[model samples]
Target: MVIEKAKLFENTRERWPATVYVRPSKGVLCFVAEPSLVDVYEAVEGSCAPSGEWTAEDEWTHLANWSFHQALWALAERSAERQLHRNDVTFHMFDERMRFNLSDECWNAERIEYEESPSRFD
Candidate 1:
């Protein structure tokens, strides 16, 4: 089983800050941040949770409390580079069915893709 330890950041402009998960793909794998950490990271990513943020909310329902799975996509869009990139930066949001790791390079790319078609989300 994979384990994670993460830290929390606070920002108010985040959307659905209370209902999310995030792994920076920059450090320890299972040793992830707290629920608040997801909110904090979201804050920096341009999403702000003005009121209280999402904490103790995003939990795993299966193995090791690992309910949701997410990855970091960093491929340039609308560029010559896009053609060469087999991994779309937008293929970020994902469930455990996609994949998981203790410390995989799959997360966090130089550029990112929002996948999910970008506009199909609420």
Candidate 2:
């Protein structure tokens, strides 16, 4: 019973939705405007499922010229679509770039998006 309860909590937390704040850092892999600026965005399940490509027009060069921003986001989109569990990820939010540990899931990257309005409701 105790073990079952623990699993229940885990499931709830995983699905409960959240708004995660990511602090900008050097390894984040995106367009960071300023040293103190933070990026903000929302993601859920498959956040990369928009009409456009993963990278902006100017950033879309070949592998040789591709910046980390393009490479990293491309990797992230693959992970999210396939639900591939990865140890690290780059996220764009508040206009700054940041990263998140994804050893267990692609869910954490999107929790904030899923729960955006929920935070307000709460």
Point to the candidate with the largest TM-score.
1
Candidate 2 lDDT score at position 38:
20
Q: Predict model 2's lDDT versus the native.
A: 0.27
**What's the TM for model 2?**
0.16
Residue-level lDDT of model 2, residues 22-43, one tens digit each, is 2333565432222211221222
After TM-score superposition, what is the CA distance of residue 44 in candidate 1 from its true location, in Å? 6.8
lDDT of 1 by residue, 5-120 (tens): 21110111112133323334435543333344344444444322335464222311121122121332221112221132122222222322234532246543301221221222
The TM-scores, one per candidate, come to 0.20, 0.16
Clashes of 1: 34
Task: Output the TM-score of candidate 1.
Answer: 0.20
- Model 1, residue 119: distance off in Å is 21
- Candidate 1 deviates by what RMSD? 14.9
